[model samples]
Target: WKIEIFFRNLKQNLHIKSFLGTSQNAVEIQIWTALITILLLQYLKRIAKHPWCLSNLTASLRLNTFTKIDLFQWINEPFSPPPDEPEIA
Candidate 1:
């Protein structure tokens, strides 16, 4: 069920359904690209620990691709304050 949702989002966001490739190889490549993109987004979400929905994340990426904005919350790391310096024993 989760995968179905992922594929649906992929088609809607990445337009996989509109793939015009006549060859199996081309179609395979298109799907692979879409999957890789989704996987990257998922990883970003995981690391950032943001509660963003997958489809929404993809849309945000597309919408902000041209602008200089901080997406993914600190370059693939979750938001956290700097650790305290260790005390000398």
Candidate 2:
């Protein structure tokens, strides 16, 4: 079968001795999953903070597919700039 051949080729190409161990493989899988999850969470947080600004800026620069207008206004409304402070005499 193709699956058997694929596994055999993978094992041979990688020069793996045996794929029976549990502890090392489990730890590696957990670490890789955690790293991927952390990266995705950070990305989502950035999107949440300034969806419109980031989307528009990145789109204008051709860095992303989303445009400023494409973002949800309710979620990406621009904050009002702080009022100017009165000058002290």
Candidate 3:
């Protein structure tokens, strides 16, 4: 019962009037769709493994450590320093 309704809705919305002459197009579309699905799955798996890839490091540090100032300084020290600035003559 439900399957019939679902098929009717899918046919109406997808405009699948007739499958008589769509075998070739369907094959090509399915191939591209499968390729896209596989690529997206692999990309997401790689991202999941790297927790620090897009995380808020400062928040994680604060949660793990006792002192806020120490964490702040540790994270900011590199950006605060001028790596190779020469002294004034």
- Candidate order by TM-score, decreasing, is 1, 2, 3
> TM-scores for all candidates?
0.64, 0.32, 0.31
Instruction: Determine which window of 10 residues in candidate 3 has minimal summed lDDT.
Output: 49-58
Error (Å) of candidate 3 at residue 36 is 0.4
Model 2 misplaced regions, further than 4 Å: 1-22, 50-89
Structure candidate 3, residue pairs in collision: none
lDDT of 3 at 33: 56
RMSD of each: 8.4, 13.6, 16.3
lDDT of 3 by residue, 29-53 (tens): 7546544644543454344433432
Question: Where does model 3 exceed 4 Å of error?
Answer: 1-22, 50-89
Model 1 over residues 1-89: C-alpha lDDT tens digits?
Answer: 98898778877767667777979998789878888897898887777655767667677677768855455543443245434567999
For model 3 the TM-score comes to 0.31
Say which candidate scores most in lDDT.
Answer: 1
